[model samples]
Target: MLRRLVLTAAASVAALSAAPVAAHADTAADLGARAGDRLTVTVTDAGEGQDGTFDLECRPTGGSHPDPAGACATLDQVPWGKDPFAPVAPDAMCTMQYGGPATAHITGTWHGRHVDASFKRTDGCEISRWDSLVPVLPTTAGA
Candidate 1:
């Protein structure tokens, strides 16, 4: 009876180990789907024909943003451990150059976390931060 019980326990363990584990696997697509990533981008004082509020939905990628696909792709390029919306360190040195009057606010959920970030072009660091978001904020390439 002990031998039979041991064999049964071993068989159970084997069956459990053999079961598919894909259900619990957290792939990028799976995480995005579960995260419900969405954002509302508001731009102000940018320039003529540049100020507006837009909606952005990623993963499935749909929204009122002009370049939803590009925006989503750009956002996806941010590394896993980095925060795309992170602000420049206060102690960091930055150029005094002004990019423009452009300013933006992005608010929503990303990667299952809340995001409330602001962008501006008042200085070099701030401009770079704003530009990094590219189409997510709005193209300021030539302007």
Candidate 2:
């Protein structure tokens, strides 16, 4: 019957659409397993003995960073759906007080995406952003 034929065609279409979604999920998992995650962080003007470039790797965590374990743990704690390296919103109000003369640049892949984010401690918002990463960006507290 025509009805039976139409139903079969619709089922085939649905299965075909679902196949791509499943394939994409599998590919993403494979990529994660193979590539893992890596990052290169550079800091300047932090203070005495706190300025340099460091490598950080996660999902097994080993690199040249001073505290790779702590840095990875801090990064993992970031809430899902939130970007840890995102810049402060332009409309947000921030304190005018200066935090310090420190600046940092972080570049590499995270969560399968390329990242090149910058951090500074010029004001309240920027300082807060810098502090959130903790060991990843040397603590500028009381500086």
Candidate 2 lDDT by residue in tens digits, 1-143:
99999999999999999999999998988678535789999999898878999999998899999999999999989998899999999998999979888899999988887889999998999988988999888986445
Against the hidden true structure, what lDDT does model 2 obtain?
0.90
lDDT of 1 by residue, 29-138 (tens): 56865357899999988777778999999878898988899999999998887989999999989999988778899999888778999998888899888888988988
Q: What are the runs in model 1 whose C-alpha is more than 4 Å off? A: 1-35
Deviation in angstroms for 137 in model 1?
Answer: 0.7
Query: How much does candidate 1 score in TM-score?
Result: 0.76
Candidate 1, pairs of clashing residues: none
lDDT of 1 at 133: 91
Which portions of model 2 show Cα errors greater than 4 Å? 1-17, 20-35, 141-143
TM-score of each: 0.76, 0.83
